[model samples]
Target: MPDTRYTFLDTPIGALLLAGADERLRCIGFPTGKGAVTPRADWHRDDAAFAEARRQLSAYFEGRLTRFDLDLDPRGTPFQRAVWEELTCIPPGETISYGALARRIGRPSASRAVGAANGANPLPIVVPCHRVIGAAGSLTGFAGGLDTKKWLLALERGATSRVSEQLSLL
Candidate 1:
């Protein structure tokens, strides 16, 4: 059967559709345009777990929290899990190139494969996938689009003030 626990969050970046299984958060995505996605009406709280997730997420959005402290159950292959695990180790304000991440995971020759896994990350911001960049020190593809990706990276480094000026909508 499908997971049942879910919630809709109004975040600084957009509306997030949060789904989970008991205490483990499964996915966090912006379904509609920024701040437009809403949780399913059938979304019923999982009591203890849901409350904790909401609390952590609230802290994150307000920029009070740098790292999350909740269980995550993102669905993916073993390689993807390795990639995500490596991503979590990336310091909050720092970033790593796909090649660097692959080398850290003991697969230096698999940079392209690592890039693929990063792109396939089931969870975006929560997993900190935005911290990964191209080998040439350039930004790359993001499921949420390049603008959102740049916003996230800038937010992490406290460098978003400039983007806010360039993009009035931010």
Candidate 2:
């Protein structure tokens, strides 16, 4: 608990709670549901600490940025961390089943475990947890709730399409 600082950033999804220390992002909380977060009793609020994050997130929502580049320090088990890292490999607008993700990590029989890790992701959109779907292609549970997940998927899909359309007209 190295003097962790926190801030709230507003985006299309909703107001987000960001917490971290020493310039590395630790957690990003959604506006509602179990993921909603409020500053802890000892947490300090500093807008300047998260300026770059705010800018990047805003750009993302506005479709100006496609991916996030930031220092992240999400706390989780080694297996969970591996899942989160693999999540980033899922290109925006594309999705895969938990079973597929499990195999990607060389754990073909660990779909359930992969789903669990996805649900427990400390970082959502940045890590792209919303891209993991049910085996039958149905959108699954997300910490930020299904609606937010749908919105993010739509945003990514739309952004990707626009990019492709731009390149094709050249």
Candidate 3:
């Protein structure tokens, strides 16, 4: 199966699942659907990528960086990969509707399909699934839940200082 090894990182938002194979990161997502950070039990214990991830995440949470420069290996079909590739082009702090994203990928009629790919994104914050909102500008489905989506949006909007208080409910 996926040769991915993983680790958990405690962040201002919550626990982040960092998965990589060798030097290439595969995914980064919320752990346990909760904001509580915890350690991962099984993974490549000494992976260098994990160390780099910790640094990058620290910079991100501190608002020192706006975009990530990490290698990604999200598992999916060709079509889904295409959709995700487009998702990555969406700049930080900016958002697009699912329909808009589908249009960007030249699949204008595949808005719902785009949503599926967004939901299936193994890398959330890094790949920026949070940038895709409902057509009506509503925060929609997120594997980490709506509150996390809200928090991410706020963080991108220069509200990192409030993340600790916002995440306390989770």
Q: Each model's TM-score?
A: 0.84, 0.91, 0.85
Better of 1 and 2 by TM-score: 2
- The candidate 1 region of ten consecutive residues with least summed lDDT is 31-40
All-Cα superposition RMSD per candidate: 3.2, 5.8, 3.2
Q: Where is model 2 more than 4 Å wrong at Cα?
A: 159-170
| Candidate 3 per-residue lDDT over residues 1-170, each given as its tens digit | 53557677778766687877765777776765632324355555544556877788889887787788877777899988998888789888889999999999999999999999988887788888888999999888887888778877788889855765856756
Name the top TM-score candidate.
2
Instruction: Point out the higher-scoring one by lDDT: 1 or 3.
Output: 3
Instruction: Enumerate clash totals for all models, in the order shown.
Output: 2, 0, 0
Best-to-worst order by TM-score is 2, 3, 1
What is the C-alpha lDDT profile of model 1 across 1-170, one tens digit per residue?
55568766667666666777766788777655332334567666544446677787788666678898888888899999999999999988688899999999999999999988987786778788889898888888777777777877777777777876766764
Model 1 C-alpha RMSD to native: 3.2
Check candidate 3 and list the clashing pairs.
Answer: none
Itemize residue pairs with steric clashes in candidate 1.
Answer: 14-35, 15-35
For candidate 3, the TM-score is 0.85
Q: 1-170 in candidate 2: lDDT tens per residue?
A: 58899988888668999889987888899989977878889889998887888888889888778789999999899889999999999998899999999999999999999999998888787889999999889988988987677778778878545544544575
